[model samples]
Target: MTKAAAVLDYRAQARRRLPPFLFEYLDGGSYAEVTLRRNVAVLEQLALRQRVLTDVSAIDLTTTLFGAAQSLPVMLAPIGLAGMNARRGEVQAIRAANAAGIPFCLSTVSVCPLAEVAAAATAPFWFQLYMIRDRGLVRALLDEARQLGCSALVFTVDMPVPGARYRDYRSGLAGASGLGGTLRRFGQAMTHPEWALDVGVRGRPHHLGNVAPALGDKTGLEDFLGWMRTNFDSSVTWRDLDFIRSHWQGPLIIKGILDPADAREAARTGADGIVVSNHGGRQLDGVPATADALPAIVDAVGDALTVLADGGVRSGLDVVKLMALGAKGVLLGRAWAYALAANGEAGVAHVLRLIEAEMRVAMALCGRTRIADIDRSMLVSTAFQRQDSL
Candidate 1:
């Protein structure tokens, strides 16, 4: 099959494999999905110039970040409740990422525990931290991640409150909150027998694994969500980040910075890197795409910190566009989740292979022999009214 056909085939397979609810959770975003669609749409508007002649053979995609070298500029974005998409979803994705020679960031809300994921993956992966109200609990989790040899600490700054995901609401996932929430969730789980037998029947899904200890053996989903809602420190600030930085001496990456000023602040706050993101357009409905905001953030830091970009990154061409726009690397979120939902480890591997191939082809066509050579000059924004077209 052709490369584009392969991706389409994967999408078709993924839809058939995953239940409607699980699929929507991976595919949907905040209210109306306005920003989510806009995110990809805006990126698609930019054009890449195709060059006629260049010695494109010997292309090198190797790159460095936080003193570590990676085979590609793509990293898996931290995703929550990944197991719902597939059995042992976190580890499966990690294994695929490790094989592909890329970093995988485990979410604070992963179904698998930090130690479990760490134990399963061959390489050191980054751990994403969602600072909770309980300082002691936060400290303990960070300490655990550090002990597990996490390469970096990614502190997500947005999402003080959960965004109103219309899809989740429509799926009745939101209303499935109560003492029997676990049972209700299980009922929904019945719809996806594959996920049920793989992750549910074989393994239990509960609160954020790292923070579950604080909840004292609670197994109810409502209780878990309650604790999470009450505990997610809404007043988190740069001062709080400093507190984290003081405790963790390793590379500190501040995630969820879309504003240029915020990126400047991240650099000023002693962060080693900053992920330019809008939380995959899951947090807010009208935020600009990460690509549109990336150049400014890179310019603001004055090359002081590594700048990575996320949100609406679907293909290798998207990765190239991000790099040309000044992002040192790109993060994949829903794309990998789709793969996980479709075919587990093999599916994720397919996505990695697909994107890498696409990136290579895009690079060759744009007269950029190497990933490092992709630049802003390769693109042109098509002048059109996006909303009307959509």
Candidate 2:
């Protein structure tokens, strides 16, 4: 197909390039996906305020996040099994992000190990961690990140219990699929020779690199899900933050926060930042979209810690919209994954340029030349309205 001109274009291309199961995993949200739809719909409602005459000549999209300079106020959010989207996919994506002057957060469940990503990096990137029941394993992973030169640690607290992602079950990504599921997936792979050759064949040893040692002999994707189901620390509480703080000596970001109370608690825990997210609408089905939840949370702790937001971000306008809502930066999830699946490092690179270019035009039109100048003022008054006020 012709080159993807926009972020959503890559999504369409990815659907054609990836196997059905993988595409569904990248595309689908939890349960009925009500919150998923709301995430985009609410952001779309906040229109930008435009001006004509103010010097719209120079647009500055550069900003600093977690002590590192970024070309755009956007980041590549961690996606588990993102490497399966292309050959050494996470590596390709990070390289692309690094080239574009943005940070890429590596997932704990990534197909490529941290060491592999670090080996390919010219600039330091961030790392995301889940609180598994095995503290020893968690500590080991932290030590690995320290040694690998990861600049930040994104501690995700949203997934104490995995959500019932109906798409995963239907795609056989979750639950016991048995022999029938295996055969069906195999057939799907056969139909998509491109993904099969690049990822299935060339991308050898598809085990989740970070947790492979604990797998012992159980090395299949199903075993990875099984390990996740069993090891996710459902009993975790705020006390666990102290434990994590003791080990990691970098920027500590608490992600998956949606409430003002939770944001305050995260700041109290001494987190460097917090991501206002509903886990990309992949965790709970009915929670308010990140856009809806951001205002109150930012009001509560915007000064105490950096407030980032992510959910249904598909373009530079979405990035600008989140910043206007008071997010320090926006984390791109499916957008980058789609680019990686559709092409590779190049696709990701191209899509990032599109976002940066779009942000430039949007900022120019809104009379905001710099990233810092982008605030609720740049958005129409609709952003100031609360749901109950409506």
Candidate 3:
């Protein structure tokens, strides 16, 4: 594999390495993808106020999140089916993240079970939960996480129901195996022989590990999808937090908050943190970008809880942008996923190195020596000025 100098390069390599069905599943957003495009567009519009001549010799990227020290203010956001990206992909990404001195969040739908990742990981990884209908199952999952020594619980609230990602249907990603619709998928897989060997052949335990025990006899991808569609509780409310809090005493973070009222409500639930995300623009098509919504949410609840943001974060400059907009840290989803798909664990480690280097340069140019020093003052925008007052 060739060296990937940037996130886009890794994305291109991932596109080449992964089958169309898998790549689109990782890349596409919901419906018209208006919010998906807006997420990047809004971030691109924010101008950084650069400064020079100040002493930027000692740049500090260290920060504390959920009472834990980290080298960077970024965490690897949970990506489902990561193991399908490579042989035991979640484990590979976790290893890379731990080596990079950052946190890796394992999704409930990950191919590698929590136990597998926990055993392989040098450090405790965070766990992300998608609320299901069965309260018993939710409790069991929380218990498993606690047993695995997971320090944080990221409860994703936006996905009561899965979004309508047209790409999945178009690519035959949701089609049952041995069906005529999957012919194109098979052909695409054939084109990527390395992925076929690494993920398709070598990647055993391809089923959703965390939820498998509850699934009983139904274990295939199609069955899992059916189970997820049926089990994701659309009726989940603020009351549900009480149930979760009862089971897990660790740091609980509400992941899909974009509104100030919602942020305040999450804080009321005694959540340790709130991630200002629009579900990577995969849930609602018209919702505001994470960047646009982050400042207000931060202003409303920053004092009560730690504020984080995720959406269209592709580079270290983007990470600095989020901090300047009042985010305590940022979560990365597709960026690391692209790296994992492109070159497995090595690609992820390389991407993290690139991001760290880029962030150091960005911080130096912005005249900020530390992560906490970045604020609205480093950004130049009329809208940001108004948000600063908030």
Candidate 4:
């Protein structure tokens, strides 16, 4: 964690520490990655309207979400294969989030089992579920989440089919099939001795934790990578909402919605909140940035539901920008993954400290003391890519 004061610093550390294939899988998006880059570049385009002499005083980053008050308005977004980044990586991340006074959402494909994370957690965390073909398994997982005291249920609905991640193919993480691909991946792992020791070697039986019951001990890393394509249920529709609502009486947040129409539909489903995301620019390549889509979605939904967002959020200032665009909170995906890969729990804790420090600077310099003071009035407008405006 030396000299790693920012999210990009941690990203550099993670790239250097991880194998080529693991780094590429965590860093790259589908196809040309146009929207992936846009997620960051467009957010940077929105200028902060700085102010002066408002009695240069204190700043507050505290906020309430799903009836729980937290120190910051940031949550760790669900990332598949994140556990491969470090030993019990999700456990480390949740620990960091707990210490930071924020919530951590565990991915259904996490490296650590739900029981393990539940035992380690001092506070309640969120659980994210994908639309898989196995309804019985989904219901069972929901029951498990309830028994474990999950504060919210995040239903990710965008990925009926996994995206065409060309980078993964090039790096031998995906399309490289058969014995030759496995050999190539093994070679890459051997090259990164540090990562090989920490995660690959010591992280034995390194398969998806929550899915182990369903997968039973038959799959390897290669099979794990391709499991989503076959298991995801494209036949799912809004009528299936009751299936989740019936099991989870907690705050149900529907993630991966980018359109106002979809946002409105989510609001009508009696959901507690909706996340305006483009699947971290992973599912589609040319869709509008999450920042670009958030304002209109927020306008369409209004107070109908709590609006959260993810994608291209790299810093505390970026979090402020998303909030100004009307997001109740922002999720950190690659940012936290990089941190976790770089230095495990300490790295994540440091990144949260960085976010807190940066957010305070941004809020105070803009003459905003409270989280509610951050609204659209603080932004200098630009010609947005999304044409629909509220």
Query: How many steric overlaps are in each model, in order?
Result: 0, 0, 0, 0
> What would the TM-scores of all predictions be?
0.93, 0.96, 0.95, 0.96
| Residue ranges of candidate 3 with Cα displaced over 4 Å | 1-5, 175-178, 181-184, 382-390
The C-alpha stretches of model 2 lying farther than 4 A from their native spots are: 1-5, 382-390
* RMSD after CA superposition, every candidate: 2.3, 2.2, 2.9, 2.5
lDDT of 2 by residue, 1-390 (tens): 222246678888888888888898889889999888888788777788998889979888889988888888889999999988999999999999999999999999999999999999999999999999889999999999999899999999999998888888887767646687677778888899989998999998898899888887777777888888899999999999889989998999999998899999999989999999998889999999888899899999858999999998877888999999899999999888898998999989988888887888899988889999989888776534454221
Q: Alpha carbon lDDT of residue 154, candidate 1?
A: 91
Runs in model 1 deviating more than 4 A are: 1-12, 179-184, 205-207, 384-390
Question: 134-161 in candidate 4: lDDT tens per residue?
Answer: 9899999999999999999999999888
- Report every candidate's CA lDDT: 0.81, 0.88, 0.88, 0.88
Q: Model 1, range 1-390, lDDT digits (tens) per residue?
A: 434455557667766666555566777789877778877886777677788778888778889888889999989999987866777789899999999999999998888899889888888999999988888888888888899999999999888987878886666566566645446566777876776677666756645577778777775555666776788999988889778976798899989998989988888878999998888878888888777788888888868899888887777888898899898889988878877877888988988998888888888888787666777888764556344323
The sequence of per-residue lDDT tens digits that candidate 3 reaches over residues 1-390 is 222246789888889999988998898999999898888878877889999999999999999999899999999999988998889999999999999999999999999999999998988889999998888888999999999899999999999989888988877777545456456677888999999888888888678889888788776666777788999999999998999999999999999998899989998879999899998888989999888898888889868999989998887888888989999989999999998998889989988898898899999998989888999999987675455421
Candidate 2, pairs of clashing residues: none
Candidate 4: deviation at residue 297, Å? 0.5
Lowest summed lDDT over 10 consecutive residues: which window, candidate 1?
A: 381-390
